[model samples]
Target: MKKITVLIVLASFFSCTSTKIIVDRPIVFNDEREALTLEYLENRYGLVQNTPTIVPKMIVLHWTVIPTFEKSFEAFDNPTLPNWRPEIKDISGLNVSSQFMIDRDGTIYRLLPETTMARHVIGLNHCAIGIENVGGTEKLPLTKAQLKSNIWLVRYLKDKYDIDYLIGHYEYTLFENHPLWLERDDGYRTKKTDPGQYFMQKVRDAVSDLNFKPLPNED
Candidate 1:
């Protein structure tokens, strides 16, 4: 009887403290953008699924170079790539997006479904979930609230998925030779430095008990 009472109290405590996630799904243009996403998955990632859903095996953290959450949302809200990124226009007009975005205040927003593939990471997009935090520049650094939120979010995702890895955007290159690295064009990679090294270390430390696989050593 005492154990049952303790369990009930613990459940109530968790329910009260659970993080709230706002669903603000982006405009997923189905015409050419969706088609291109499908083709990219198939041709680049060797995924042959009929839909864009993914069996997420990893979580990749990022920092939006943009300063404000509103501006960041505006950029990803569109399905077509804005004209500024003309280099990859031929590949697809589809804009880059993440499954979740965290504001400076630690407000969590869902930009896409958990299983849906988003074009945030380069090679592992087919099997990874992306988390984008606003403001990564020197003038506007990430916040403690954001860090707390990230820890909570990562814990939530780990509980829900069979996630095997957690890495920063900068660490994606380390997986180039791994089976998950499947970009067809070796030269198509973009330089990334997001959610900084220190930030990732903090997050990893907070969730170390989860025992996620360490980033592969660079060969």
Candidate 2:
């Protein structure tokens, strides 16, 4: 009877610990967005899936340089790429997005499906999931609550997917030679420093037991 009681208690504990994600679909999802996403997969990454979806192998953490959740959501909410980024216009007009967004208070919001492709990271988007936190600027730094939230989200994803790596946005370039890094245009890469190294280290340390591969060595 004691053993059964212990098992019940453990189950209850786990149930309480699981993270709850709120769903907030992007304002636009249509044939245009679908086509642009597919074009990006094929033209940029050389991946031609029958559908606009990916089998995630990595999770990339980022920070919205944009300070507020409303603005960040508004930026990614548009399906078409804004006119400001003319450099990537030739590739596709699809605006960059992520699978999930976490607010300053550590509330997790799902902007897109985990399997659906969102143009967050450059090279590895074909098989990587992106998590964008609300802020990364000096005035609105990321918080401990956000850190804990990211740790929980990473663990949750690792449990459900065959996730092999966890990397910061700045580390995306390190995967240039990796088989998963498939961007066709050599000049298409963008420099990034997001969610910061210190924040990523804290997350990595928390999930060290997951045994994900270390970031590829810098050349």
Candidate 3:
């Protein structure tokens, strides 16, 4: 029975590799305290805490769209929020960054600590693990090795954290009606297609045994 259970888990893990977020490196935190301000956390992630806040809920996936992992890392390494992301920066001192980045070859780079919110998604950062992939072009598609790494990372995160939902960046807007999408009302929105749909489904299926929360307004 134990061997059967292991086989079942392995099979599920393989089936869901397509949409996993691979963390190729160790996670690092920003020394700048401004990045951890409550105002910033509430603004970037819709996290409201009259007290110390710690809630681990979802995992959000993305693609750098940028060509290389180093460039992606450099963009995230900054302590100051980039002007391009000012709308969000204004809301929270927290600059935009992800906890993890996966390269074209599937090498994962940990940009920030999972516990410290590194502004990645507009309304879900407080409770989501944002995993950024290196590139999103047909010429250099996300690879098999990367997919395997993603599975490993997802399994680890699911076991370690109370992660409930897993979604691609493109699906964020869909969550606008959910409780998590409570960012300031600048009417800010971005249409994104990263880490692809087919990729995501595989990941979802792989971790299906974990019994994720029902998506808002599901049949």
Candidate 4:
């Protein structure tokens, strides 16, 4: 009897948490940062065009420790990274900015228009749509409102762009061995824990219809 009771409790707990674990769709809030353009996308980040060009295949989620939408907007607009983003220097003159930024109140801002190669992630810019969320501190973990907005955005992008994969920023390294890996320095990789794993799962579940590319089988 005790065993059965424990199992039931576990199932209940999991059921309650499951909904919070992953996003069901992409965010679709108003593009507060629409003025940001493709030229800024290129110059802010010294990105070189890859031959054959990359397709819009992945949607990556991120978080800006910096609070507020305007601050995040300014951060993406500038070509130089603030002293905070040491990761920016490794990519040469290339700055770190996503195609989209989600504010604290679940406001979605478009720093750059869709399909344009922004320097949000190295090697995957040609193909990935970056979405950065504001406020990632323990006290300010992403909110449920943000999660719902993310789902809306995912669905919107999936319909609009030929998006294949939806992932969190931390999973970027997992693609190192995959065909998408294009950096000259294969050894050069950054460690990240943005937008949280649980948060990503929520996004993936919401946009599962997009059908992410299957990771190649091990050699």
Candidate 5:
């Protein structure tokens, strides 16, 4: 019975994969938040959709830079932006979040539904799923365990959806000219360097066989 229960849960959203996803959906997605997401999509992406869902074309990797899993989760669990993030508050109150969060120990936590539009990225939030790692500072770089888990999670998501590109948060700007790029305000961009280069290379190499499409500016 226990085995059957687990299988049922997996069948709902994901395909058969070794990656264990722990659902810790503390981020509020009530009527107000949903309304805000819809407004963001229409205003930012020029998409007047009745829902705030995405088609899942890309997978974005990020590092929280917060040094601990609890603090990182708290940062995103709120419905609206906190006071410190005034730099981006002028854009939208919808707090930044991701579909998945990986702890330093490689424990995978699902913060929101995979198709929900998270404000983690600027130009591609309409169609990209974000994966946030717990720590990304130079003093607390992403761990080996997190790397292994990210590789597995990437493959699992690729097989489950029509994912075409895998990218680190820093590389999102490269898609500015691509058709999938949808941010209306060109000047509303912020620099990012999360889930660093070495970490990205390792994960990409692990899933090399998946043949994800190249970035728009990749040489």
Candidate 6:
């Protein structure tokens, strides 16, 4: 139960600014995970670095699709992919993870350090910070509380970093050949629909004042 507290100034739904909290419920990022991260960075992004770190330029949001917070947490807590996820296991044993995760009740949890490189997105893991939500299946759509929390996180990260983009998981493919896309394998892409359009749009609208750069299709 190691924890670190962060106090962020958030824009309330009614346009007033208030302080909000982000809890640090860390997952296992031991020596083994760090080694995998470094190897993945070098092999995937052509970055041969001694330490696995990323200068975040974007924020990508995702939904767990696995109902409970504990289950979703467990999924990303490991350093290697589990046996059940055979489709992506061979791609590199590094498990998928995000820097932040939100529970259905709008509880924001930090799964990893914001600056660390996480294997959440396809091509932009080298420069994007990820935020995952607890639920987004047809059985359990993302909740309003989650939307508000996401909006808050987007603003917080934008203020803390030089973030140039805010995107949903599905929009990741749009950056395929753009300057930031760094995946060497052209065929290593996968279709995604986590944290759907409506949810993304709501979060976008709430933080529209931030003026994040347009997605590839928007221009």
Report per-prediction Cα RMSD to one decimal.
7.3, 7.3, 7.5, 12.2, 4.3, 2.0
Candidate 6 per-residue lDDT over residues 1-219, each given as its tens digit: 656676555544446686778888888899999999999998888999988899999999999998999999999999998999887777789888999999999999999999988999988999999999998999899998999889888988888899999999999989987999999998888889988999999989988988899988555
**What is the C-alpha lDDT profile of model 5 across 78-185, one tens digit per residue?**
888899999999898888899989999988777778998989999899999999999888899899999977887887788799999999999999998999999989
Q: What Cα-based lDDT does every candidate model obtain? A: 0.82, 0.84, 0.66, 0.63, 0.86, 0.89
lDDT of 3 at 128: 78
Higher-ranked by TM-score: 3 or 5: 5
Query: 1-219 in candidate 2: lDDT tens per residue?
Result: 111111111111133655355545454668889988998888887777778999999999999988888899888888899997787777778898999889899877777878999999888988999999998999989999899789888888888899999999999999988988898888887788997999999999988988998778665
TM-score of each: 0.87, 0.89, 0.75, 0.71, 0.91, 0.94
Q: What is the model-wide C-alpha lDDT for candidate 4? A: 0.63
Model 6, poorest ten-residue lDDT window? 6-15
Number of clashing residue pairs, candidate 1: 1
Q: What is the lDDT of residue 15 in candidate 6?
A: 63
> What is the lDDT, from 0 to 100, of the residue 111 in candidate 5?
76
lDDT of 4 by residue, 1-219 (tens): 111111111112212432222222222212332223233334433344433134688888899878776676667666554576676564454446777777777666666556655666655666788888988888889888788768767766676677767778877776775776565566557778998988988887766656777544323
Error of 4 at 60 (Å): 0.4
TM-score of 5: 0.91
**Of candidates 5 and 1, the better by TM-score:** 5
**Tens digits of per-residue lDDT for model 3, 1-219:** 111111112323544533433343433343464436466665555556653234668888877777887777777766666788655665655556777777767565666566656567766666778888787788877777667666667777787888878788877776777877666664777667878987877777767777887676543
Q: Among all windows of ten consecutive residues in candidate 2, which has the lowest summed lDDT?
A: 2-11
The candidate maximizing lDDT is 6
Backbone clashes in model 6, listed as residue pairs? none
Give the lowest summed-lDDT range of ten residues in model 4.
1-10
Q: Judging by TM-score, tell me the better candidate of 2 and 5.
A: 5
By TM-score, the best candidate is 6
